[model samples]
Target: MLIRLIYASRAKSLGPMDVKDILESSRRNNTAAGVTGALCLSNGVFLQCLEGDRVVVNALYHRILLDPRHDNPAILDFEEIIHRQFGAWSMGLVSTVADNQALFLKYSTGAQFDPYQMRPQALRAFFTELMGNTRWLA
Candidate 1:
C-alpha cells in the first residue's frame, strides 16, 4: 500500500553548501531506491515527506538514521494524506533555506545565513513549499 511519511532533523551547524551536498546525495540515493518525496531544510531543521511502498519508506528512514549530519531526528507527520503535493519526484527533491525564515510564508523568502527561531507556522509553511515544488517533470 502507498504510505506517506514525514520526518525532521536538527543539523549540527551545517552551512548552506554543506546542506546542499547532503540533500543532493539524498536525492540521488532516494531516486535509486524507488522512493519519492520532497525535502526542505531551514533553521537547522529538515522536513521531508516520502511516499511509496511501506517497505521502501521504512528502509529510507533507516538510512536517514545512519547519516551523521542529523541528530535527534523526529517523525513529525506520518499519516496518509488524501492527496500528494508532490506528484513528479522520484526518490526525493530537496530544498534548503539558510536562516530563521521558512521556504513558505508571507515573505516566501528566507534568510541566507544565521540561525533563526523555529516558529511552527513558518516551518510548516516551508515544508508545504517544498511539497509544492515537486518536480512533475521528473
Candidate 2:
C-alpha cells in the first residue's frame, strides 16, 4: 500500500556542505528505493515528508532515527494514501529563503517554522501549498 510519513527533527550542527550532501544522497538513494518526498529546513529544524511503500518508508524512517545529524525526531503524520503528492520528486529540498518567508509563516504557529507544533492537517496543507509555489530550492 502507498503511505506518506511526515516527520520533524532538530538539526545537530549542520553546515552548507552537509545540507548539500544530504540532498544529493537523498535524491540518489530515494530514487533507487522508489521513495519520493520534500524536505524543509528552517530554524534549525528539519521537516520531511516521505511517500512510498509502507515497509520501505517505515524502514527509511528508522534509518533517519539512527542518523547523528538529527535530534529530537518526531513523526508528525503517517497514513495510507491514495496517491503520492510528491510523485515527481525523489527528494525535493525546500529552503527557507526570503521569498518563501510568508508562505512558511502562513502555516507556522509563531515567527519561525516549527512543524512539531503544527497539527497533521496543517502540515499537509503546508506541503500542498508548497507544491504550488515556485520558490523552493527543488
Candidate 3:
C-alpha cells in the first residue's frame, strides 16, 4: 500500500553544507529501499514526504526520528492515504529553505500543538502546497 510520511524538524545548525550532508544519507537510503518521496529544507526545518510500503515507510520514519542531526523534531504530517500524491518524486520533493516570512506564514496555523493532532486547516494547507507545486524536487 502507498503511504506518506511527512515530517518537519529543527536543524541543529543552519549551515547549507550541514543540511546537505544530513539529507544526503536519507535520500540515498530511500532510493536504495525503493521508497519514493521528496525532502525539503527551509529555515532550519527539514521536511520530507516519503512513499512506499508499510515496512519501508515505517523503517524510514524511525530512522529519521533517531537521526540526531535534528533536534526537537516535529512530525507535521503522517497518515495512511488512499492515493499517492507524490508519485513523481523519487525522494518526491525537497523544498528549499523558506524565508522567515514564509516560514512564519506556513506554521502560523492555529491547530493543536501535538504532532498527531488532527487539524483540518493545517493539513489542508500542507497538502495543497505540495499538490500545487508539481516540480517540488526540481
Candidate 4:
C-alpha cells in the first residue's frame, strides 16, 4: 500500500549548510525507511512530498511534525498512489532563492509560494511539476 503525502510549513532561518544538512539527514533516513520525496524551500516556507508505504510515510511525516526547524506544519494532501513520482530521489531539494522563476510563476498566483492559498489539485500540480523539472540532490 503505497501513498503520497504533501505538506507545507514555515521554516526558520536556514543557511546553505543547514539545508544541506537537512537534505543529507533526510536522504539517509528516508533511504533506510524506503521512502522518497522532494523538498522545496522558498521565503521561509517549506513544501515537501513523500511517497512510500503508508506506515513509513506517515511515521516520517510525524517525525517532520516534531522537528523544531519548522513551525505550523500542515498536511496539504495525502492519498494512495499507483506509483512513486519521486522514485529516483531519496530526497530531492530546491530553494527558490536560486533560479526558479518559472517554477514560482506557475505555482504562485502572486509573488510568493504560499501553498495554503492554493486549491488541492493546484497544490498537487505544483509538486508534480516540481519533481519533473528540478534536479534532485545527489
**Alpha-carbon local distance difference test for all models:** 0.60, 0.91, 0.60, 0.83
Off by over 4 Å in 1: 13-17, 81-83, 91-130, 133-138
Residues 30-135 of candidate 4: C-alpha lDDT, one tens digit per residue: 9999999888887688888899999999988998888778898888889999999889889988756455757867777788778767767997787778866764
**What are the C-alpha RMSDs, in order, of all predicted structures?**
5.4, 0.9, 4.2, 1.6
Candidate 4 runs further than 4 Å off = 135-138
TM-score pick, better of 3 and 4: 4
Q: Compute each candidate's TM-score over C-alphas.
A: 0.64, 0.97, 0.68, 0.91
TM-score leader: 2
Better of 3 and 4 by lDDT: 4
How much does candidate 4 score in TM-score? 0.91
Clashing pairs in 1: 35-91, 100-116
By lDDT, who's the top model here?
2
Please rank every candidate by TM-score, starting with the best: 2, 4, 3, 1
In model 3, state the lDDT of residue 33.
Answer: 79
Better of 1 and 4 by TM-score: 4
Candidate 3 TM-score versus the reference:
0.68
Put down candidate 3 lDDT per residue, 83-119, tens digits, no spaces.
7766654554445434223433454443312323435
Q: Model 4: clashing residue pairs?
A: none
